[model samples]
Target: MPYDGFKDVKQIVKGDLEQYIIYQNEEVELKKFDNFVNLNDVLNEMEIHLKAYNRVASIQFYGITQDPETHSYMMVLEYEQMRIFEKI
Candidate 1:
């Protein structure tokens, strides 16, 4: 991937549903499309679980990853400029 044009990514897209890396900095190298999650079936329900203040999240990670220090299979959700962490 080209680092020069690396924008602050919000979501990874697979057809209709989308996701993005939870956090990206010059030090972190996230592999795009390493894992693709199909949220088409569960997004609505997921939003219900993670929603806050009536704002629905419309972004996710392109791949499933563990927080290096946590080492757990976690889901990173982004919406309304906030990031939500959930264990799946």
Candidate 2:
């Protein structure tokens, strides 16, 4: 389900979600995703997690891939267009 960057993002945030459910750099399948949880929670959490390591002025959410079984996701977030993956 492709979400409109503007309207959909906000809807997802308002939904019941858990940011801690997000995953990174893990060996998992992306072909499938968990329909049970709102991915927005993961996105929100990912952004929060990123801020912990680096100083992020702003984040332009791009894309994501979720592992169906574990219900966790892995994504590459550049350090605010610095072309850096992440500090940690």
Task: Evaluate all candidate structures by whole-model CA lDDT and list the values in order.
Answer: 0.36, 0.37
lDDT of 1 by residue, 1-88 (tens): 2233334644443422244432454322232222324544244444444454134444433333443332323334333333222211
TM-score of each: 0.24, 0.33
Candidate 1 lDDT score relative to the true structure: 0.36
Query: Using lDDT as the measure, which candidate wins?
Result: 2
In lDDT terms, how accurate is model 2? Answer: 0.37
Tens-digit per-residue lDDT, 1-88, candidate 2: 1211112111112222222221242211111223437777666766665575356444444457554447656443332342232222
Question: Each model's RMSD to truth, in Å?
Answer: 11.2, 12.2
1: Cα error in model 1, Å? 14
